[model samples]
Target chain A: MTASSASPYQRLHVELDARRYPIHVGPGLLDTPDMLVPYLAGRQVMIVTNETVAPLYLERLKRTLSGDDRDVREVILPDGEHTKTLASVERIWDALLAAGFNRRCTLVALGGGVIGDMAGYAAACYQRGVAFVQVPTTLLSQVDSSVGGKTGVNHPRGKNMIGAFWQPRAVLIDTDTLATLPGRELAAGLAEVIKYGLIQDAGFLAWLEARMSSLRGLDVEALTDAILRSCAIKAEIVARDETEQGQRALLNLGHTFGHAIEAHQGYGNWLHGEAVGAGMLMAATLSQRLGWLSSEDMARVETLVASAGLPVTVPAAMSADDFLAAMRLDKKNIDGRLRLVLLSGLGEACVYDDTPPDMLKALLDEFPRA
Target chain B: MTASSASPYQRLHVELDARRYPIHVGPGLLDTPDMLVPYLAGRQVMIVTNETVAPLYLERLKRTLSGDDRDVREVILPDGEHTKTLASVERIWDALLAAGFNRRCTLVALGGGVIGDMAGYAAACYQRGVAFVQVPTTLLSQVDSSVGGKTGVNHPRGKNMIGAFWQPRAVLIDTDTLATLPGRELAAGLAEVIKYGLIQDAGFLAWLEARMSSLRGLDVEALTDAILRSCAIKAEIVARDETEQGQRALLNLGHTFGHAIEAHQGYGNWLHGEAVGAGMLMAATLSQRLGWLSSEDMARVETLVASAGLPVTVPAAMSADDFLAAMRLDKKNIDGRLRLVLLSGLGEACVYDDTPPDMLKALLDEFPRA
Candidate 1:
């Protein structure tokens, strides 16, 4: 169906010159051929999805891009964050080779964050990069990962450690796909949605505070608004610093700590967003201790995250030392100094490298594991 | 020793705007701390080399970048084209993670083409790219591979099937390193040098025709002059098409067929330049068949390649079918049709997608494989 005839969709653009693309959010976007047709560089299409997503949306997406001129193939990988590795990306490479796919072929990532990261990375390296489109099926990816051009697999020692900043030709976000999303996974995605508010938009945070219940209910209007706003904030930051040379690093407000939480919990255990939820709390507390975030603001931020059904505390087993060691491995560290994204105040985040180790340790010790 | 006190080095610049870097070609470059120290972004330096090169130049390179504040480490892999794989790159990742090397760390590739390719790729992906310098020790790498930003590993299916176009911060070509290079490997590198002549500068080809003896003898002046000219031609093409979307494909004149030969023979058996030497012969013959090259010119090309002590014949085992299958996997292929870099006439090359398959098959049939 043409976009004109379809239900109104919220469109956000990632304004990277020459490499820019639009993110379309609405129900049944998977079936909108017009949204996908213009971005396809050639006739060949390879939809890379996970086993979990394949059964539910693979055939549906295939039908959307289906045409006699299009030769579409699908590669279904096993699900989970652990699968986000070079080995998994190699599988995608092998599949493309086996199929004799050329540089003209465009890979469509049709799952959540893991598939998007792995598939996009595969596209980036395959023949030194081929065109790819992101069809993010989960809220986490649709709102956060898919919009910005961050794509890569994970190293065993770190999260999202091995990757490329490969932008997709387009991002198609079908909110209807969230019906299949498990409750915990849904809550996990909300963590990133809340992140936008804590990092840059105080107004958005207040709106999220009042509309948290509607979002949890999967209210289409509220969900679309949050995803659109979140993507816009990310897209603006990404446009300004596509390579994370400076301001782009601000988007990782909770990610440095969040990545540590996921790594400590063995990747797939805590869920990325859940860890980010708890990690953001730690960042807020740390920011407060550093005289950046006020105590009342930190309480409000923690309450909003807690009310979203996300974790507000660290896992019981990880110690302050463990947190320090894990955070040191983050991509933001420079010459052994840990650069962190901390709030100067609620709804205002900035990257800082001056967080004293003693204050960082004190904040970490206060969090009861688990 | 400092660069000022040593014999003046021949310097050439690759004009890529913000990514522009200089190529320093001379003896004793490894010991010239002045050339390397300025490019280093941080104190942490990871020297990536091969087992063969480690004992020879590793310590010399370490001293060049060494300072009390600098933390230096080394990662050595088995030396061979076959070792250029995703798995090999992972080992680099593991070492960086183990050492807690952050994004601030810079990787120095301290070997030939294989080392440069794998190490450059590792740097490209290590935390979504960090600073990397190329200290290419082989003739081929200094003249071609290292000068351009084309870095990647080989797949069993195709040479450089998985990689990136990650440009280096600088390329330090210590021609003195050639003293330790094997004879056949040296000849293999010369093939690429001859390629610059055939594809772009007829004058270079004629110059190489006369100086074949001096180059083969590893005369410093002749080698330095050749490397400078070859790098100038490549940097021009690369600046125009950093990502082989256009003019850069011309540099692959023999590489399309050359890669197939390497893939078929099992990479590392035939040195890259040796394969390209034969492949260029095949490409010249085919170009003649297509009426783009004169029969007399083809013979001159073959004679020049043979005088350089490189192969002019394909392996005795590969059939036309094998060539077709291998060439199909090349990155230049589009929509399953082979796009080859063929000569329009001597000293002039262009990317062509319309090569008649029957003529290609006939030409491949003429070459007896290994």
Candidate 2:
């Protein structure tokens, strides 16, 4: 099915001047072939996908852009979050060079957030920043990674430790792509969806709660509208503070805690969306303890996450101390101080530098029981 | 021993608006402490040097940058052309991130072309590109690598195969930086210097012939003026076309042949400068064979390189076929066709795509037996 232009998909643009991009979200945006051709610049196109999603929707997307001047190539990487490693990145770069790709080539990332991040980074490093298009195939990616130009492979020591802020030429999010997604993956995506509400748009959070059941059941209109709104909000925030300085740090409400869980559990054990879901709840739990959040607000976050079928608590295996230790090494950490993005309330967060030890201890203590 | 502001040196400006950089070259330029301040930005500067050059001048440069807010951190990598791999890049990135570097940080690359290339790539990759200053401590880096913003790490499959087109904030040359350089390195640097003459400045080539003995002895004025003029020429070419779309290819006159040699011989065995030196001779020889260059013009290139203590002929161990095979895999090669930068005359080069194989073969057969 082609994307319906009638869907509430607004184009959120990245302000990179001549190298700028647009994020298009709606039901059939993927079928809009003409929108992407301008940036291709008569260059060869490489669509990088993965196995799991390829069997589902890669063909229709490929058929959309089969034009006379555009010569398209495909390289499918192994599927999953764990594949975002240096080995994979090297493979992407090598494959592109071998294919006679030059400065005039465009890389299309066609899976989920993993493909988008790795492919975007590969484009950035390939001949030093080529144009990339994000055909984000997952909800987490459509709402998050696809919009921001943060691309990289994971280091053994840390996540996205080696990366670049490479912006993509355009982000095409087909809501139809979501129809083939597994229920668990779809729910995992809601974690990020809910995250937007808690961090930047509390009103979106309430809308999510009211329409939670319909979204969980995959209502096409609601899903596309939700994805576009999330993209627009994220685009505005990124435009203002492209780098995670002041306002952008708010976007990481659940990420500091989320990174610890992902790194501690080892990548791929829990989906990144799952880890962020738990981390978002932890942030809410800590906020309640700090008296910045009421017990009702914390419960509201937990109830919303639970309704979306996301895990709402930390895993029993990892000690809060280990989580703290892992978080201290986060690239976000300033000097020796552990900087965490704490919520002032729902729909707001600020970078909290040098949090008192007692507050950290109290927060960790709350992670186990509350 | 400070650089004389009055009559001795020429200042060439690289104007990219806010990213503008000044190329300061003259005798004793290293001792001019104030010249270092403009590129430093804030206070902290990290000096990335290599084992070969560190023992000689790292302390002097560090002392020059020392004051109240400006503290210098030094990282020394192993010496050799082969050390420009991604591993070295990781070490540099790890060092910078571990040191709590923010976006405002500046890096000073203080060695030869290898050190300059590696450090500049690191600065470009770290935190998604930072301001890096090139304090080229070798002749090759001072005159050539310092002026160009091409920064990258070498991949095993290809040299500079994975990189970005990042420009340095400024390039500072202390003719004194060349004093500690060994004979082989000094000769390697002149290969690139000779390129400027063969490609754009025939007068400069003739001047080199007349003062061959004085230049070999490292006469301060002659050396410094040559470096400044070479940079001025490169700065002009680069300002017009930073990316090698058109005239920029002219800069690769000897590099195509030299890269093939370096690839076939393995990178470290032939220094990059050494490879280029041999490559230039072959380029001139091809021009003469093509009947586009006079015999005298070809002889001038060979004699000047030989006088500078650089190798002016290909190694007999590698056949012409081996060199051709190596050149075909160069990043510049597209669709298995070899593109060469050939001299139109003494002072200009034009890129010729897919030169007749017989022409390349005949030049190979004539490889300097006498």
Candidate 3:
């Protein structure tokens, strides 16, 4: 069916000059051929999804993409964050080569953040980059990973240590896919949606607080609004700073501490958003210590995080030193100085490299543990 | 020493807007810290070289880069075309992380094509690309790979099937290194020099024809001039088509057939330039068959390739089917059509996707076997 006849959706563009593309958010987008067909680089399409997503949506996506003139294939990788490695991407590359796909081909990432990240990265380097369309199935991926064009696999040493900022031809968010999402996974995704508010939009945070129940209940309208607003904020930031030169680093609001948690716990143990949820609270707490946020502001952050069903405390086993060790290797750091995205106010995030070491250590040591 | 006092060098820019960088060709550039220090992105520097190149120039390079505030490290990988893989690049990332090298870190690729390609790719993906300086020591790399931003690793299925077009901060070519290059390797470098002539500059081809022995004998002036001319032609093409949208494909005149030969023989067996040498002759012959070149024109290509000490035949074991199979997977092809860069005339090339299969099979079937 054509987009005109399909269910109504909100569209936003990541304004990247020549690489600008649209992100369409609505239900049943997976079954809409016109939404996807135009953005394809060529007739060859490789659908990279996880085993978890294939049974539910693969055939439908293939049917939408397949035609006599097109050669559509799929590589169903094993699921989870642990599988986000170069080895899995290599599998995608191997499959592309095995099928004799050329530079003109397009890769359709049809799963969550892991699938999208791996597939986008595979496309980024396959024949020095091919076109890729992000079909983010998870709520987390929809509101976050799919829009900004940051793609890569995880390293044993750190999260997203190796990757590229390759923009996608388009992003098709089929909100209907969230029906199969697990409750914990859904909560994980809400963490990022909440993140948009904490980092850039105070009004959105208030709106999210009011609609938290609707969001958690999977109210289609609430979820759609959240995704739209989140994408709008991210797209603006990415357009201004596509490669994270300066302002873009502010998007990592809780990522530095969150990465430390994920790395310390070992990836795949703590969901990225869960770690971010707790890490955001940690940042808020640190901001409180630094006089950037008031006690009431920190309380509000804690309440919002806890209400979203995300952890608001640090992983119990991690120590201040463990956090420091991992944070030192974060991609945001430079010249051996730790750079972190911290809130100057409820909605004002800033990248600061001057977080006093002693103060940071105190906060990490005192932060509540799960 | 400064570039001014450091044995005068020729410098050219790869005009890529904000990403534009310079290519410096001269002797003793490795020892000139001023040439490299200014291009570095930050204080952390990681030099990625191969075992072969490490013993030869690693110390000299390290001494030049080391300082009180700078963190200079090295990852010496096993040397060979076979070592160019994601696994090797991972080692570079591993070392970078171990050293806590952040996004501000600069990667110095101090070796030939393999080391440069792998290091450049590692830098391209490390923290979504850090700055990299190409210090290509081999003749072929100085004239070809190092100048262009095309960096990648080989897959068992195809050569350079996985990679990126990440530009370097600068490329420093120290001609003095050629004095230690192996005879076979020197000849291999000459093959690419001859290619610049066949693909774009007939005048340079004639010059090469006249000074082939001088170049082979490592006459510094002749080699420097050849490198300069070759780089200028490549920079012009790359500036016009950084992503190989059109004009840049001309540079791959022999690479399609050359890649087939390399894939069939297994990588590392035949040097890239050696394969391209043979591949160029094949393209010239096919151009002759297609009525684009005179018989005498084809003979000149053969003589030039032979004089450069490059093979003028396909791998003995590869049949027409082998060539067809490998060439089919070439990155240049579109929608399963075999795109070959064939000579339209001496010093002129065009990407033709309409090579009748029957004619391609005939040419491959009849081409001489090494």
Candidate 4:
């Protein structure tokens, strides 16, 4: 562990110019006024959250941010992927206007990935962009979404079909917030954590293999280590390719297949992480067939994801044609060709644009009964 | 004139990295396919325009862009500032989705500032941004909005209150399009053309003074020179400060008051150019009040604006309090203090945040009966 992690907390820096910010991971970070208040660019702030998260954390965060001089307001939406729409974002805009928020006003996203994406996009468009801070209260958000600059609401036709690469001013991840996370949501977050290992860090995969049980048991040290490492990996990639013209596409390792599942089954039917877990396994099947990854390693990859309580099997009702049609609609596809991220080995991945259709079909066949 | 302008048309380059693009200013450009087709990034093109502009130019543009292999779509919206809303942008989004446009697909904005703003903003958000080209047909768009990377829809409370600084791949300015433009709209464009001269180019202002009659007569050469010089000046400023952190704010020499007028009068009630023309005079009044501009120089500025057929006086109905309240709501203000872009001298502007309230009050009183 680094020296920062050796203390009660860990702080990692995202070094993108002008947009450079810190991600602080520690216990009870939400209670620490110093972690969030100093990052506010103005006295006005709007905390955007969803119903599920609002009941648990909104009032507490409001209390922490409230003061005689500050103007703090809260805007809440119904909790679900269906709600990640332009209409939902209009509520935030209307609220900000009602509160007379200006260009210098800050938007603080105080929930999971949905809140973060919606609020980040709101800040990006409000007065041609405003400062925003991410208070990610979910493991999924802290480890993935909140660390990177991608933010948007979804269109009915696709997940994250609309968005911008608007980075947050800072990220405050309180590990204590994870205590309220449901098991399924927690497992969803681990899928992305495992992704960092699968894509760039072989050693991290080995480490995750050893600590899976501790993570499931809600061990604070394990959770902290997972989030810190995941954020560090994401921060590194995002800093290098903020606009995703190149290497950053590798971060979408399972997202093409995962998004297809989410869109096919209807968003929110399959939790994003669950679909990604199963999708990663499906991608591994293709990688094995292509001879980049051995069959044994592919099975091992499946086992790790399965052990995390994430679905390794695609839903039984979806046929190969169904998956094919959905995958073809992914935004990553260019000129009618599906570009996918496949494992070169257990700990390494690369984007491949020349995937054979037969191999994709063969891989989909194996997942149909799962 | 530069060698490029020696021909029947002229081309100016905006040199911002990656976002660097050419601004082509000339006559009869809409009749030429080479001016547009070469800049398209893909076979799929969505041309966004408005009702008034569509009847006049849409079919001609479509005819120029059409081919057996290319997929071209057109989205025509109601013509006015009110239609520049999130709901209106949703129409473009829906049209793109319905036609299955992808990341590589290019959006071509084919009208005035409103079309460019909405289309550019749609391009910025669609699939986290796709390539777009601007075919700015109006004078205001050619000189100002189309050159800078600002794109967005207006909020109910303010003009251009929601947007992104997403640059287009290229800008195609056809001075021939001005032949069909309404006299009022033409004058509105002149307001911005004069703005460039007022802010950074006294020599350009002198040139405009000599050629104002020719430009008002829509003489192709005069119009072309005015646009080419104006775009070059804007391009330089935009390249230096893509985001309005410092120098870029100087480009808003009259916008702080102009937006206030537009927002208070209800956007479209006062044309953007008219508001800006009057607002520039108001800013000049403040400059003179602060002793930065001599009374004689300020009157010359007002005379130039009046010659262009734009309002040089604030409307009689707006009280000092009304203008003050409206200006206070401007996004440029920081920490509740209005930051006026005041003329330091003829052809030189600077952002001044410490403008005395009394000076602003005095300027408003002067405009009540102009």
TM-score of chain A of each: 0.97, 0.94, 0.97, 0.97
Residues B40-104 of candidate 4 have per-residue lDDT tens digits of 88888999999889988999999988885889899999999878999999999999888878899
What docking grade applies to model 1?
A: high
**lDDT per residue (tens digit) for residues B10-70 in model 2:** 6778765556678877666666787777777556578899987888888888888888666
- Across A1-370, the per-residue lDDT of candidate 4 in tens digits comes to 1225554568988988777898888988888787889999889989999889889989889989988589889998999887899999989998988787889999999998999999999999998899999999889999989977899988887788889989899999999999999999999999999999999998999899999999999999889989888998888998888888788888988888888788888889999999999888888888888899987787779889989999977777788888877777678778678889999998888889898878777778876455
Candidate 1: lDDT of B170?
91
Model 2 docking category: acceptable
- In DockQ, how does model 3 score against the reference complex? 0.88
Query: Which tens-of-lDDT digit does each residue in A164-274 have in candidate 2?
Result: 788887888788888888988998899888888888788898899899999988898789778877777787788877766668777787888888889888888888888
Residue A65 lDDT (model 3): 97
Native-contact fraction for each model? Answer: 0.88, 0.30, 0.96, 0.73
Q: How many clashes in each structure? A: 11, 2, 0, 0
Best by DockQ: 3
Using lDDT, rank the candidates from best to worst.
Answer: 3, 1, 4, 2
Q: After superposition, how far is residue A329 of candidate 4 from its true place, in Å?
A: 2.2
Candidate 2 lDDT at A352 equals 77
Off by over 4 Å in 2: A1-12, A26-44, A58-73, A243-246, A282-299, A317-320, A333-338, B1-12, B26-46, B59-74, B94-107, B285-296, B317-320, B333-338, B354-361, B364-370
Residue A256 shift from truth in candidate 1, angstroms:
2.1
User: TM-score of model 3's chain A, to 2 decimals?
Assistant: 0.97
Off by over 4 Å in 4: A1-8, A66-68, B1-8
C-alpha lDDT of candidate 2 relative to the true structure? 0.79
Candidates ranked, most accurate by TM-score first:
3, 1, 4, 2
